[model samples]
Target: MTPPQVVVVMGVSGTGKTTVGRLLADELAVAYAEADSFHPPANIAKMSAGTPLDDADREPWLDAIAAWARERVEHAGAATSSPYGVRGVRGVVSCSALKRAYRDRLRGAGPGVFFLHLDGPPELITERLGGRQGHFMPRTLLDSQYADLQPLQADEAGVVLSVAEDPESIVRKAVTALERAAGADNGSGQATG
Candidate 1:
């Protein structure tokens, strides 16, 4: 079996990060975390007011998530076997790691921090965002998110999937691609999946 790792389902809001992350966690049989859960109330309030979060405001929030990832990865190392008899822990988390720097901060938690970026055109994302309910993120903030989004660099260990496909198809591709990558690399990003 491949070694444990954290898969961060990332994208701008309304890209189905949380939905796909939950499904992926179930399929991977690992812990699932919502990025918003790591945000401070102040951050939520800011976004609720249609305000974009600058890096300074995100520092603590990112730090909190990073700390959680570290703990999860650390505990994973100590686990001889999981309930599924796996060797270590794996986690699927939904985070809007829009900027490369934010992703780098997450990687600081440990190795094997893979990113699964969900991307699509603004028109589609705008539609989805409009349909979403009970969410702090306003559709007005989407532009700022798109502006801040940095596509995955060549050095990063992750894949980017388009949101043009249906949710199930996207999730299926993600699972297949991630597993293949793990198997091909022995959990390293040395070869194509």
Candidate 2:
């Protein structure tokens, strides 16, 4: 049996991380998490109010999500009470993870943790954000997100997937990318993609 995978579907806000992440989780039959759900009320309030969070404000939030990832990997191959029942110990989470440092922090969670970066033009993302409703992040913060976004570096264990495709297509590509990464894991206890 293949070992579990912990993947972070990452990108700027409005880039469909949650949509694609959930779908990807379903495709992989893994448990899923939304990084937003781990935020403290203060962070939500801040974003809802159009305030972009600084690194200090984001530290704890990142730590919380990282902890969740760590816990999931630590318990790989074990049974857990979850809505997704009897999954293959794999885990997927949606997070902005706009910076390399942020991605590194998440990677520190555990081994075999990889990322699926959803990227697209700012105009496209802006349009999506404009049509969005009932979300804490405002369209105004889109610029900040774009500015903070650091593309996946060479050494990162991940792939940069475009958001130009439909959500289903993106999920299909992500699953394939993840599978390739897993298969390429070369026994170094890390994802090689």
Candidate 3:
């Protein structure tokens, strides 16, 4: 039996991580978790007030998501062992894992964990941020987000997709990348054990 694939859709604010993540989850018939929903209210307040979140503000949230990912993988493993159980389930999470360390923490959860980096030009991201209604992240902080972004390394187990593309295209690209990665891993007979 094969293990489930977990994908972390990552980018700075207004890069459409949540929207694309949800759509990707739907297309893959998997579970979708929004990283923002796990954030503490204080962190949201800080960002809403045009204040950037320091490492201290992000530590707890990142830890929570990592734990959640681990738990999901464990649950899927258990279910797959049952005689009448469903096939393994995939997990798609939307997060602003701006730093390499954050992405590493997520990868530590399990093997076959992929990161999908959604990127776009600053001008486009700023426009999207401005157009968003009632979002906690202020447009004033878009610059801060751009400043904090760290591009994923070539060796990372992930794909980079352009947010400037249509949302449907972005979703298609992400899902296809994940499927191909899963196929490769399965063919190689690697286990997440």
Candidate 4:
């Protein structure tokens, strides 16, 4: 059997990471997690107040999320006992792992932790962010986020999908890429979870 997969759906703000990650988890029959939920209240407060989080402010949050992913990978069964686990299955998470170091921290959780980068034009993302409501991340921060993002290297075990297409199509392409990477035979894509 293939090893369990821990997928980190990563992108700048408004790239549909949450939406795509959730759908991909559902398609893979696994749990979905939101990395934003793990952020400390202080971090949220800073972001809500229009201040970009400095690396110092983000370390704890990143470590916490990585630990959560680690727990899921280590204890494949009885995942319900902890939010960190996936309830007897694999899982996906939406995270803005903007740097290689951040991705490396998450990868420490397991060998199968793969990243999926959602790439799209700035105008497209701006439009999407504008239509959203009540999100703490302001569209004004997108430029800062873009400036901070370090694209995944070619050697990394991950795939980047364009976000210009419709949501369903994007999911389909991601699942296909993941399935091919995992070498699974199931229709939805290989069981990376």
* Top candidate, metric lDDT: 1
80-189, model 4: which lDDT tens digit per residue? Answer: 21222222336889999998888888877766677888988899999999999988999889999999999887546677888887777877776666656666433323
Tens digit of per-residue lDDT, candidate 2, span 42-94? 99999889899999999999999999999888876753322423233378999
Ranked candidates (lDDT, high to low): 1, 2, 4, 3
Judge candidate 3 at residue 39 and give its lDDT: 93
Model 3 misplaced regions, further than 4 Å: 1-4, 77-89, 185-193
Q: What are the runs in model 1 whose C-alpha is more than 4 Å off?
A: 1-4, 77-89, 186-193
Candidate 3: give its CA RMSD in angstroms: 5.3
lDDT of 3 by residue, 1-193 (tens): 1334677989889999999988877776677899999999999989888999998898889989988888778776432211212234468899999998888888777875778889888989988888899888888887887888888876577778888788889977765665556555434322110
TM-score of 3: 0.86
User: How many collisions between residues are there in candidate 4?
Assistant: 2
lDDT of 1 by residue, 75-160 (tens): 76444333334334478889999999999999888876888899889999999998999999999999999999998887787788
TM-score of 2: 0.88
